[model samples]
Target: MARFTTSTLSKYLLQAQVAAQALHTETAPVPPEVHVPLRKQLKDEAKKQKAAGKKKKKNANNQVVDGWELTVGIEIHAQLNTAKKLFSAATTSFNDDPNTRVAFFDLAIPGSQPIFQKETLIPALRAALALNCQVQTVSRFDRKHYFHWDQPSGYQITQYYEPFARDGSITLQARDGIAAEDGDGVMIGIKQVQVEQDTAKTLAQPGGVHWLDFNRVGAPLIEIITLPEIHHPATAAALVRKVQILLSAVDSCVSGMEAGGLRADVNVSVRRGDDPSAPLGQRTEIKNLSSFKAVEDAIIAERDRQIAVLETGGVIEGETRGWSIGSTETRRLRGKEGEVDYRYMPDPDLAPLVIGDDLVSHLRESMGQLPDVEVDVLIKEFELTPKDALSLTALDGGMRVEYFWNVADALAARLGLDRIENLACFQLAANWILHELGRLTSERSEAASEELGFTEDGQCERLPVEQLADILFYLHTRKITAKIAKELLWVVFRGTIPEKYPSVLGAIEEENLWFDELSETEYAELADEAVEGQEDVVRQFVDYKQYPQGKLMFLVGRMIRLGPEERIDPKNAERVMRAALPEKYVPALKASD
Candidate 1:
């Protein structure tokens, strides 16, 4: 240390005194001469800044967690149901013996060359149109280099630099239970859709030996990539389901997650701020998620984990993870691969794919109504509840939708009605088809389903649509009770209609399967007989504060059962019971009603 001169020491002391005075001035009360408006303005500005800093954010679960935001994106690889493999003449079969379907090109033989299949492009174009993607007239393939037993060629052919389609989006509607708070649908953008080849299946043996199945090698795939704009796990899952519906509607792919026809790779990240323009957080991808529930649960689990790590002052590592179904968590697989690691290069064997404008137009004209469009039509034209419409359309690739339409058309034509006097009947038909028919069909095995004259996808060929419509029409006209209608439905479903009757109405008339309009005196006698043995239940219903209100229906049904030979009107029995009771108990009876 060097000694300081007296002048230098005085200079340092003066600087310290000035800093202390400024600090005191900031902390202490202001003088009376300070303008009140200026002081108020400064306080207001400070409050605004604090409020902006601590703004609330929502997690992937749509729960409020201040200062935390979630981001999610998905990549889907769907196997095309084409006749042949992408670059070979081998037939595509899911159930073929392990390596029997492999072509020489699939094995990377010494002199074999890849011959691109023209059949695969039709489905790819269909998918592009279904997703609202812009198809590229000229697109080429590139080789993605990697070292794995799954790819014997040491590289897989894909579209890296130039993809088949781009700039598409799938809308998740609010009625479909996505973004319900917004009251409108949210649109998830598609980055690109590429045609690529899939890797082989790897089977691990007991002693760590691996078995390779080349049946899936060089199979055609259309990889769809979406932008990192989804903020909720539910939204991400909805996007996946919507893609499945659209692909199936266009007849492009089977879109079966359980059958391994479609695979999803979910990329999830979490950031501290809500500003979308801010740099995205480091993402970890959960690869090869095989189910919709796994897609949702994995995103939620990974997002929470990243948030937890960041809260503890730990940095997130970029890696690939696999979802553990048993533990309900994500386990690390390996470090994430970047573009440089893939070593992508253009494939010199195949020329650029050229699509004509005429083909696109022809395909567009040939396409039928898509699933999303049909969903809206069901809600608007037929007045179906959103839940019921979704349930009907989502089953077996819209097979239920077709069945429902057949019944609806039969009813409308027979009744000579449009939306008039048939809205409730339409809804009743929907309930019968979706609930009763669905449950009945779901209990059958594949063999049993076929025995009932149903296709593999549950399309009915033997069920009489007109007879089912007659049952609903009779119920709507109050000619038959709901119980009788259900019984007739069972008879119709099993093809057990009586031999003498030519039609459903004829059977109902011949068998007298209808209710008798009971007189008031007869209803009174039935109510009195019903109450003779069930006095305790009647008293409890009267004192409903102590007993459940469902006892009233039990008493009513008991009265109806007293006249079991003929179907007596239940409402008449209920009315007689209420009138026979004390007038003071009438209000309690109304409460039960």
Candidate 2:
């Protein structure tokens, strides 16, 4: 055996000391007798450190011993990319005709055996590679026994004693605004990632009736655990967002939160660095947080609850809790279980995964540039802000980023504009997609429930990406006012645009029928016609040199209400109204203009 060097021995001794010191202040039961030797080793390491004139770095945010500092970790369960279930040949598609995709093995019928799919292993390997983790050549699955109505099998197959990968890192950013960057941020570390299977979903209905959908049962999932390095609620949310983006970039993992493709389990604990020897407070595992806002709220609520418990001298018990997003609180669901609680036994049906060089090579080749590297490239090559780059790369849907890039390039070409390649433009696209499009879709969906057939929902649902891009480009070119764009978008949503418009001086042609029905000359004449009918408002405008701002819109509104029959062009209506109005009133008309 090789002799231990002074530095190596010193390092081990210091770690042992820290462990021993931590154990000493515990009010709970003492550790096993085996820890005594570990304590001695730690003392030896501390002495070695002293001799070497070294001091451990202090924590970033220093607080008094009595103050609270949270220790947060996340365990993300991402469904693997596979055509079928892990142990069965049943399809794993979501929202499919229920029970139709299940095989006998998935239903756990008598005498039905489990057989692992080889394609499933490839995604796990690819995920491990994407995470920069050390993949174990001989990882084995174990049985995680549990009893639930949806789980046909008595236990879930998971990796415990030896996981597929161990030790990794992911970096993210915290933005200053909902979609803006201008804030301080830090890097967090990943602990490990393991492959597992998802349980079926339980849907509860009114009248106390519950339904079980086994459509998702036995679907492969990867659980990624992070170190307790996060310091703030916002950072925790941002980290999850980053992970979603990274997973999406890796083609194997779907990154849709709405589709239930990804889920997160957050672990939170509080400790005082000044008293590192003292045991950290009880940890709470927040279960299955599906949204970033919910995760942040849960973290804040858990931290506050933990602080309250400590202030009252009440012992914080370790347990699993469910987050109530509406109430912004966590309710204890069950007691925390140790590894032994699951009775983890090696899975007998599936053989050990023997990772070969070719397998590793194939996975590596499949791995494209990860989000972080791509963000860096965007910043360097396109002169994008760190926040902007992160926003573009952090989109949950894989195609959103690509679509954004395509639109940005198209806009650049159409407008003869530079900096189209900049990530800031991509960030703009992300903001619009996440906020504007999302809000529009949601509002339209609600309206559809009570409204007629030709509603915004129908229009929005049919809105195409190319048309949206064209509208945006038109706005950017200043060819259309914001108001006109909005109207045109509604038109596009409800009607079709012609191939071309008639020349400004030419007789309106059939191709420009929509506009021809609302010709500029006709609109000017309508404004004149409206003046004849609304002489009182027109007299007020001429005498006071200003019409009531309300009346201006009302007049314009009348002309527009005339539709194509009255032949009113909105732009010409505004122009004719301004030209006919007195000088003082013209400014008000211009303001409307």
Per-candidate local distance difference test: 0.76, 0.64
Question: How many backbone clashes can be found in candidate 1?
Answer: 0
**TM-score, one value per model:** 0.80, 0.65
lDDT of 1 by residue, 1-593 (tens): 34445465345433433432442333332122222332344357557756667432223445324688888899999988798999999888676656667766776765678999998999889999999999888999999999776787899999989998999988788765564433477888999999998887765444444555677889999999999988877778778878887887677885577667899999998887768678889999899887676677788778878998999999899999998442346899988555237889999999998989899899988987888778888888778888888887877667778878888888898778985466888988889888766645553523235433544343575566777889988887778887898778767766677455788888888889876667787777777777675656756755455545477778788887777635676776777776666553444456666
**Ten residues in sequence with the least summed lDDT for candidate 1:** 26-35
Top model number, TM-score? 1
Per-residue lDDT of candidate 2, residues 412-498 (tens digit)? 665566754434444454455444444443435543333112221112234445555666665444444444555554544443553
Error of 2 at 417 (Å): 5.8
- The lDDT of model 2 is 0.64
